[model samples]
Every structure is written in structure tokens, then in C-alpha cells.
Target: MARTPTASAGRRSRTKTVLMGGVYVALLGLVSLIIAVAVATAYLPSYGELTKRSDLGQMIRVRAANGAVLVSLGPSFGEWLPYAEIPAEMRAAMIAVEDKRFRSHLGVDPIGIARSVKVRVDSGRWRQGGSTITQQLARNIFLTNSRTFGRKVKEIILALAIERKFSKNQILELYLNRVYFGGGAYGIDAASRRFFGHSADHLSLGEAAIIAGLVKAPSNYAPTADAEASRQRSGVVLNSMVENGFISAAAAAAVDPAEIRIQQTTRENSVRYFTDWALPQLDTLIDETSDPIDVWTTLNPGMQAAADRAIDAHTPRGVQGALVAIDRDGAVRALVGGKDYVDSIYNRATQAERQPGSAFKLFVYLTALESGMKPTDTIVDSPVTIDGWTPRNATRTHLGPVTLREAFSRSINTVSAKIGAQLGFSTIADMARRFGITSQLSTFPSMVLGTSEVRLIDMTRAFASVANRGVAVTPYGIRKVITADGRLLYQHEQNEERVLVAPWVAAEMVDLLQSAVMGGTGSAAQIGRPVAGKTGTTSSNKDGWFIGFSSGLTTGVWMGRDDARAVGNLQGGTAPARAFSAFMRVAVANRPVEQFETQVPIPDWQLTPEEQMFGDVAIDGNVLESMVDEDGMPLDQPGQPPVDQPFLQPGRPGDPSQQELDQAFPPQQAPPRANQYPQRPPPQQDPRSQPPANPSDPGAQLP
Candidate 1:
């Protein structure tokens, strides 16, 4: 190993060459960075534009159908707080979790980047981002969320520019105000008010930690989405705060996640589902608004509250229910997505597509009506076969011949199937389209039995058309939009009513629907006033529904589970109908009561004797005379009411209401024969009223 001077010289030369090559590479990288920054800067907004932060300052408020402020999405710029006013705990929690060395860093943190790279490498995934608060603010305001190397480079350059132009406090304030907090929330204040139901200044240590945790994955950890997941994420922030000395370890431990009170909405219950539905419509209605705007929705708060209560009271455990109420003009009055918005945000009213069961019969009947079928037309309730599918009545019994009105009110499957078969399934499907059902429908015979799945809103809207007297209704939630300066951004202007069927047909359908609520499966939906609706229970009891209209408002109720499992023995008549009545009682409490316009006698009022055998009201006097004992001694003490005692009066203590009776059978002229109604058998004669012969036997029956 003789090391000559030449060998030593060669090693030194190689070292110098390596150093020069590294220097050239470093210099080229620096020049490239400068070029990239210049290009990115050219694409960026002016400094004044960035500082103004208009997007951060703007918000959207949703109003009730009555114009009451329901909620505000985006930052509450009206209540925007200065850095000095923001809660110290919130600031500390944010600084500890989001950027530990925010104050010391210059727009970008090398240490943080190194840590992020190390974490991604160790975990084989991008577990965390290395962008500082300033970089996030820059990205949020000036760039789209494209996960590209170019975007990241621009983000860093813009962050540096922002840091140069603003102070640390200003950067923090802007970042806090501009950060997205999921659920259409854009700032700390809105998030605070939305989740904690208070101002940002009032956030507690635990609350602050939870809010800080929301920065990473707001939707996944939002209190409304998953309270448990939110709590765990908040715990991580609390630990981070402790590690950063922002809070003492003991203090963090004392804050129990379970005890945290998470108020999702300013109102105790949520109209979030309603807003969720309306927001997408906003996107389609308007391109974009530069300033904060107000969306005047068609939601009735009173009705919404009633809907909430009704669903809460009736929906069975482990199952869900939805209710949607619409006015004659298709204004969505009230909508309940689920019993609680926190448990589920998937709106069953507007989202879930379940079998409507017999509710879809509305289409079949409407088709028949348009095809010259009257409500009074005769239909056989006996078993019928369409293709190979045989339809059976829910009661497992059938009348030989029944009026169309009777068949509909009773939701007789055989009758509806036969009508569908006659009209052709495509005819019914076309009727459904005319009524506003946008979901795909089948032309199969079973579709008459509501085998086709549909959204509750679609069914409600379809019913709404019939309630609107055959005029088509397009269900809408937003009424108008306005800016803070009262400039109209959007206003709903109704065009001419699209007449889907003849008015008389709608009137006859109303007559049939009223009968259902009067004395049919939908009896549970009967309120004091007139109601026209139908009951729908799908096979295996998977879904129950009642869609009806009263006082110019159409309401539809659906009860089911999320997994499409059977809901025990739940039926539309009992749970959904009761819920509809309970909600309508309050929803229409203030609205004027109006009766549906119908042609007299509700069509087919005078079916043959065979038809009357199927429980017709208005019995023949001859039949009344025939109801007697074989003794033939006049069979009566004798003044006896014809027909059942309950049906003697339009409204008895336990009988259908007067409106139901009038709707059932409007009075025409006086009866031709006397004694048409033999008065009810005289009550056992009172002993005290009897003459002197009865006085001796006061305790005995009077002869």
C-alpha cells in the first residue's frame, strides 16, 4: 500500500470535481425555483385581492318558507372576530395541532416538511400535509384543490408572498376565518356556531380542541356525522395541545369527551336535510354569487317541527321514517329526513328510493281516469291474473263487484291490477311522469301494486298534482334568493299549470282518496277535517307509506329501515298514517279548511245490490225491511234506524265525521217513500215514564 504523491493528488482532484458537480446542480435548482415562483406569481391575484379575502367573508343564509332565517352557511363575517377576540384556548389548540411553530416559521416550515415526509414514508401513505397555516390560506383563496406538483409549488410561492405582506397575527386571523370546516361551513365562527351553538370567543378548551380537530377531516369528524369519531379526533388534538405546552396534561385529562355538549344547529332539531337538498339546487339555479346571499326556501318551520315530532313519536326503534309535505303549488312545506339528523344525514325523504307499494296506485287510477274511467265505474275485486302474477287483496277477502271508488279507498290489489292490465303498464308510467315522478318505472303488471321503487319526494309530488286538481306540480324548495343589499338574485316564477288530467278526473280521484281516509285502511289518518290519501304497505312489510292531502297541503310519510330489512309488521295505515295526521294537525292548524271540489255522489254511488253487499253506505229501504227476525211479529218494538246504528248520522260519537259523510254521499232530493229509516228501536221504555199501571212495577219493564 505504497501511497505515492500522485495517488494523493488524484483523490483530491476527484473530491474537487464532485463538489463542483454538486454546486452546479444546486445552482440550477435555485434558478428553476425562481422561474417557477415568477410563473406562479403571475397567475396569482393582486396583493389587494388576496388581502381582501372576499370569498372568506361571504356566507349564505337559508330562510324558512316563511322567510325566517333557518341557518347560515359559510363564515359569519358579520360576527367575524379579530385575532385579539378569538378564544385564547382555540388559538392555542389550533397552533398546537395545525402548526406548532406558526409564529417562528417563514411561510414554510422545513422541519414540518421533513416530519411529514418521514411519516408518509413510514406509513406508506400521505398521513399528513406539511403545508403551514399561511400556505393553507394561500391555497384556499387562490387555488383549486388539485393534488399536482405544480399546485403545491404555486401554493408555497403564494404562501411566501402572503407571509411577506401580512403580519403573523393577520395571517392567523385570515387562516382561521378562511378555513373550510366541512358541511358547507367555511370559517371558525360558523363552525363554532354550527357545532357548539355559540360564538368562537366562547369556545371551551375541549370545544376548541374539537374544532381544531375538524381542520383535518371535518366531514368525517363532525359532531353531526359521527360523534364518537369526533370525540376521538378531539382527544388527539387535546394530546397535541398538552405536548405543545398549550394546556397542562392534567387539564386535558379533566376534559371528558363524553361530557362535551355538541349542539349541531341553532334550532334544537335540524333542517340540515332540507338545506342539503336545497344547496345543490342553488348551484344549478345560479352560477355563483360574489357576495353573501339569502336563499328563501319553501320550508315551513311550524310544519317542520310537527313533522319532526311525528316521526320521532311513530318511527320504531332501529328503523327510520321520512315525511315530506308540499303545498298545491309544489312548495315543499316540511321535510323530515330521519328521526334525528345526527344519526343519519342521508335524507330518506329526498334520497331513499323504496317501493311505494299501493301508493303508486295513484298513477294507475289517474291513467284510468284519463282513459274515460269514472270513480263510480264498476270493477271486480275478485282475484285477477296479469301474466302469471295473481294479485290478492290485503284483507284476503273480495267483493264480487265494487265501485272504482270503493276499490281505491280499500286499496284492493285485484282491482288496481285489473285496471293496470286494461290501461297497460306503460299508460300508468306515462301518468306518473305527468305527475312529476322522475324515477325510472317498470311497465310490468306488478308495477300496479307499487313494485317500482321511488323517492318519497317524488311520490309526494305525484300526489300533490292530484291534490292540485289535476294540475302538475314541480316540487321546489327554494323560493327566492337575495343579496344583503336587497338585490334579487333569483325568484321562483311559476309558469302556467301543466294540466296532466281533466279536472273532473282529479275531483273523482279526490272522492276516492277521501273514502280511504273515511272508512278504509287509512282510517288512522282521519283528522277532524276532510283528508284524501292512500295507505301503502310493501310486501314483507319492508316499507310503509301514507301520502295524503288536506287543506291544500299534500303530505307523504314513509317508514322503513336503511338496510331494506323488514320492519316487523309495520303498515302504512297505523304508523305512517298516524304520523301524517299528527303532523297535519299542526301543519294545517292555521290554514283555512277547504273541501275538495268533487262531482256529486263521488261516482258510482248507486251500485247494484251485489255491489252494496261489499259494505256500501246508503242501503236500500227494502234491504232494511228485510233485516228482521223470522218471528214476523214486526220484529221490532219498532221504530228502528235503517242501516247500522253508527251510520244513522253523518257524524256519531264513534262514526266518521260529517265531512266524510258528505263527501261520501251528497244529499240530493227527499226520499220517495216514508219510513225509509225506521227510527232506532225505542230505548227500553223507562219505568218512571210509564203510566199508573207501571208505577206498581217501577222496577220492572213497562208493557
Candidate 2:
């Protein structure tokens, strides 16, 4: 009886305990519901407001340097599709590649997440994303790119909030707008235009597929950066389109893989040479702007094309060259740094420091002229050493005596050196500085040979001074920058500075340079019209240069190996002159021909009796010489009767000084008797040496 009573008590106690636990569980469940409701109610409204206030549709504006809109920064961060202008194929393609359940999912799709997780585990990598359209939108708007547990929690909260506040269409729009595409583009619209040079609405099925394919790895699939990778990814997108029923299997099969014309956007303002030179100037002009300002430079498209073509045609592949072309007023028209702008952005024309070679002699001559040294002054062209530095002419032999005009025309190194030494290196260096050569000029005597390095733009500007009639004009690219509302933000004016050389002196210099093209070192630069220029070839043939000006423009061209190695046998007259000629041919085609002004009239100064006998006279700012022929070739061959004519005797002159003048200006010597030409039947010696029997013979015409 006692045992029975105990068992009953135990059963009763167990029942009571069970009841108490149920009550406690019910109370705890009620509290959990209350806490969940409170948290949702507190955060849902703020999340809803965020989804409702998404500004993903705002347009981004991209303007030309001249205020013309090249393209607008499209809405959706970088999503740039014109409103309601996206094509059906593009939309279908996006949905096919990114989220097949885009339309059916509310904010989160449980089945999609499960499948994505399965795929990730099977692949042994997180290659698949389970985010629905709502999740993607939520992350883009409110979540950081943090893979932390807290960020994931916040992402889920934002996704739920977005689902409660916005419709499916709105979420899709936000998602598309906020997605990141590579190449500094944010949205599909910009990506489409940046990759294909067209709008989203204009994309073909293949193009749409390619763009949609980029979402997985934008940089990796960027067609400009990696065409093969992008093409392969496009195949994946095409396959997905077929698998997702967006495109028929037959349609996918019929699509030709090679027919996908992946056009790259041509960056019009990306001329590396000109842009490199113009960047610093742009910084100065827009230095005050908080944002980088677009610069619509005064670059002439035609001239720029010519410059690019010239450099490409002249420079060897992998070798670098730089060219600059400017209007007479100092407006930069065109610039080309290397063969291709995309290959490298370093602008050789504006940034490279190179030896100017004999091309810089123009400054020396101009300075001398400015300092009252007439172009006609007689100077000895004999071998001269300055402080153990012996400067020789390009031709190993000296001309004994020649006028300043002839020396300069021939690019005589020795004569140029003598002139520099006579005028003082500081004077020439100062003159170069005034012309805008900012590079440090070496104090050595070799500096007169353009041993100092200078940028192509600075040299071009210095030459422009001569073309601008001694008025130095600072070169500029940007004309103006303005706000979207036409508020003038920045403007550039013609900055001019009058240095030392007079307009007349510049004019005279121009005339003297014309001789260079007519029959001198720069004869290769002759177009059908009159041109004034100088050719420069450095020692060991490192840099080849030609800088010249026409009546309306001034241009500079440089050709050399990027590695600073010798360019074989290349000379300035070959590549640089050819480039200059080709560019000028196009640049001056439509302009009226204007002759360089002959500022100084020809002088009728009397020649002394000795000067007359030696055929030397001061005329037209240069000493006149009759010893050298019209082609600037010498008249006599030493130790032999002057080839075609009798040599003028030394002492049969009106004045005794005539002998001295003849000796000073004697002609070059022929080879020694032992090395004389094969002895032939000596022609019958005629008193007059009556010109060779063949009057029509070209050699007989030699002086």
C-alpha cells in the first residue's frame, strides 16, 4: 500500500513539472515575438526611406573641352543608359547572365541561394553569387564591400527593407545603376559607350551579350585590355542566354562567334604627345578648380592626324619620336609623342629633354644679328680649338674663308663655335633663355652646339618667337571650361612677351633660313612652296631634329631611339625633315602663301680693290663670295689647274691685299700626286682651257 502511494506521488510531481515548463516556454515565445516586432518596426522605416530615396537614375555629364557634351555621365552610379532607352536584347542579356530569377524574386530567393551555395561547394570556390536583384541593390546603396559578419547582417537587413519599400522594377533599376564596370566606368550605359562607342539602346544582341559578360570580372573582360578573355566570357554569356530560355537554342547556334565586332572607343583627346605637353599648362589653368577640368584644346584635328602619320612613317617601331605643330599665334595644333598613344602615355614632345644639336644654332645666329653682327661678315672657317675642344665641320675639310651666311647655311660646327666664343657663351645662353628654353644650359663651350637638353615644346615656342616676329607667345591648349549651366569657369588668353630681338631681326633671320631649304642642309624639307628651317643631327647620331616655320605656322620634329642609343645612320634631314615636310604639306595646304619679309634691303656698299679681286664684298648683311659656286661647292682643286677653269692668280690684283684675301679664301686641295687620278693622255693645254668639248655635259658646268 505504501509503495503504490509513492508511485502516484512521483507521477503527480512529473505532470506538474511538465505543465510548469510549458507555461515558461509559452511566456518566452511571447517575449521573443515582442522583441522581433520592436526591432523590425524600429529599423524597417529607415531602410524603406533609403530604398525610396535611391538616386540611381541621375545623369552624369561629360563635356568636351569646348563645352560640347561628348557623353553624359549616365545614372545608376555609372549606369549610363538613356532613360527608357535600353534595348530589349540588352535587358534580356543582363537578366540572363546576372540573375535569371530577377523578375520572380521578391527581395530574396531561398531556392536561388540554396543552388548558389551548392555550386560554390561543388566548385571548391566561391565563384557563384546567391544575391537576388534586391540584395544587389541593397548592397550597392547601403552596404560596404566588407566580407565581415556584421556587414553581411546589415546587407540582409537592407535587402529586407528594400523588398518592403520598392517594387521589383525599382530594385532592378538601382541594381543596374550601382553595378561596377571596369575602365573607370560605373554603369552599363557608360560601359556600352566606353567599350563600343555607342549607347545601350543601339547595342546588338552580340554586343549586349559581351557587355553583360563583363559583370563577372570587368577588368579581366575589358575588351580594350584583354580581347581574348572578353570574347571567351561573351561565349559564357551566350551559353547562359540559351540555357535560361532568354534566346532560342537555334538563335544561339546561328550566332557567328567572329561576327562580334568589338569596337573600342577612340579617345579623341588622348593624343599622348600633345596631352603630355598640355597637362602642366592645364594644371596651371585649372589649378583652382576642385575637380579635374576638361580641356578643349585648340588642336587642329587635321594637323594632329598629319603629325601622327608623319611620326609613324618616319620613326622605327619601338623607337620614340616627338612632334609639335602650332599656329603662328602659338596655339598648339597637333602633337605626337610616340607611334601609338595607347602603347605609352609619356609625351616625348613636351616632356623629353634632348640635345637640340645644330638646330639650336638659329638662336646663336639670331643673337649675333641682334648684337649688330651682320649676316655678311667674313669669318675664317679654318680648324679652331677652344680649350682643347676642337669643333669640326660635318665635312672633315675646311673652306678656309666663308661668309657668315654660307657658314650657317652649311651648319659649320667650327664657325658656329667661333661665333659663340666671340660673342661670349653667356650672351648666347641668355638669348636661349629668353626664347623659353627653360632647361639648364651647360656652361661648357659645347653648349653652343646645343649640347644642353631642351623639351620639344620649349624649343617649338622659341622658334615660334621667330615666326611671331620676335614676340614670344606662350603656347596654350584649353580655350575655356564652363559649368553645365554656362557659367564661365575658366578661360585662357593669348599670353605674349616681347623679349630682345626686334621684328626686323627675326624677319632677316627668316630670309637667311630660306636659303637652307633652297640649297643647304635642309634641302630635304623643301615642299613646293617657300619654307624656312634648320636640320639638326647630334653626335654619334643619337637625336635627329628639324624645327622650322612657314609664314603661318611653326613646327618642330624629333626622331630618335627611346633607349638613347645611336639611330644607325639616321640624320635630321631624313626622318625629322620628312615628317616636317609631310605635316607642312597638309598644314599649309589651304592657307594663302605669304613670303618672308626681307626687312634689310640689299646694300650697295663699295668693295675695296683687294676685295674686288678676291671677289669678296659686304652685301645684304653677309660678306659676298665669288670663289664658291651657286650650289655652295668650291671652285678650285689644289695642285692642279682649277678643274674646269683657271684658278685666279694670287698677286695679279688691283691691291696688294688681294693676294692675302686669295690665300685666306683658297679652295680645297685634291689628293696627293701619288694618289692622283689615273694618268691619261693629257688634254691639249689650251690658253683659255676652252670649256670641255661636251658643252652639254653636266660636269663641264662645274665652276
Alpha-carbon TM-score of each model against the true structure: 0.57, 0.68
Estimate every model's Cα lDDT from 0 to 1: 0.79, 0.69
C-alpha displacement of 541 in model 2, angstroms?
Answer: 3.1
**Taking the tens digit of each residue's C-alpha lDDT, what string does model 1 give over 201-266?**
888888888889998888899887888998999999999998998889999999999999987443
Best by TM-score: 2
Return the top candidate by lDDT.
1
**Residue 374 of model 2: what lDDT?**
69
Q: Candidate 1, clashing residue pairs?
A: 376-603, 376-604, 639-679, 639-680, 640-678, 640-679, 641-679, 641-680
lDDT of 1 at 449: 91
User: Can you give the lDDT of residue 192 in candidate 1?
Assistant: 77
